[model samples]
Target: MSKKDSAKATLNDLNGKEWVKATKSWFVVNPKPRSAGQANHPAKYPEELVSRFLRFFTKADAWVLDPFAGVGSTLVAAKELGRNAIGVELNGEYVEIGSRHLEKTKGSGRTYLIMGNAHGTLEHLGEIFKDSIPPFSLLMTSPPYWNMLRKSRGGNDSVQKEREASGFDTYYSDSEEDIGNLDDYAEYIDTIGEIFDRLEPILAKNAYLVIVVQNMRDIDGEMKPIAWDLARRLSKTYALRQEMIWCQDNKRLGCWGYPTTYVSNVHHHHCLILQKR
Candidate 1:
């Protein structure tokens, strides 16, 4: 028998060429323009981004989960790729917008967007699935980047000002239960860790999780390595496979602390890929 005929592709549906291409440690994805309803979400990552990971991580008809579903980007992406998806979102407005978008998504796979905190949402999956919740083969999400959105960058070129002027939300939500609203950084990291740790029961063995996150500069000029911190925290629960850098070349550059101190225009996010043990 020929090697090509005998070799099996187990992780995903990608062929040899596609599999090799996806193995690269970094990728570039500039977000597409958002719709009016989608623009209401302060931190809505693109569906295209989610679609790329979905294609590389899961096969057709595989179940996917997104715990931090903002406007149902992950859910929509999963459906488009013929993968069943379940999303847990906190904000009601975002959930409504996500549901509207999900309705228009045309695909063979089913999708459900539950409006509730991700921390406790998994417990109620039995009520929705009737028999038992399917073990998710892949989990891809970009959770809140701490409370950085609420911190004023103190510049006229700040995107927060433009968002506020355009009547859009500047942060995820004002709810006390929101992870992005937490003030204490250590507690915030711990909470996120706990959330993922709880998913052990629902995740299929060897299921891959791709978390899109980034390091940030605090208002006081302190560098917060959020991406690394999260990787370290989650490593205890899930096997830390590797990190893929998601770079964006389309974002406009801002002179953050120019002429006095060096400040880079960070246009990349860390895609930490982990596997269920």
Candidate 2:
């Protein structure tokens, strides 16, 4: 389809992301999924989603970075789309998994996979990315959703400490670099905002920073309206562009009728697409 037609089609879907433009053999899928749930980084994300963001938000040969590179979905998609990609992942095992895949499939585009604490990236990122550094045109990352999606029955206190623990050797050996273990709601926003704050210098002047987060059900099964809170918090730095809805194909089944206060099974997630101004 033509560029104009493609944009129109993309806007038609009310999902978290949409397909934008295509170049060669591949048709890019936008706004990569949150996590692929691999054994290492059980939540790496889908490549199709990453490709779409690269296609529309950036030009060919542009630079992209995934702060919590999880399992390399972002780098894989960026390389495929003819863009340079750098992934900063905390867990060493995941870095191995993602880097190995990147080396095997690398073509004209290059990828740099770093296994370390991403919070301190500013100190040495330039040296490591000096030869490879380009003004990051796009940043598509999904921070840890406060670890609220856990199946355990522990209180919020326990979840925070456990979330930061490295999941490299265990069954759920996943890392939480995107959003570290901040217990309080206020702390969660502050911690994540600080991470984004560090990335400001590396991003291009007008780069787009897109964040994907789903609201969580509290211990009492109440929906915590985090999207609005996050938007308000981030508005201090980034300009809130558009709040897109990512409707999940699968939502929890069953509901109890409350005559006084009631809502429905929340099927959609909030994709807060913000730009650094």
Task: List lDDT for all candidates, in order.
Answer: 0.89, 0.67
Per-residue lDDT of model 1, residues 51-86, tens digit only? 889989998999999989989999999899899999
Q: Which candidate is the best by lDDT?
A: 1
lDDT of 2 by residue, 123-180 (tens): 5577785655678888887776775545343333433235446443222234454354
lDDT of 2: 0.67
Whole-model lDDT, model 1: 0.89
Candidate 1: count the clashes: 0
RMSD of 2: 7.7
TM-score for each of the candidates: 0.95, 0.72
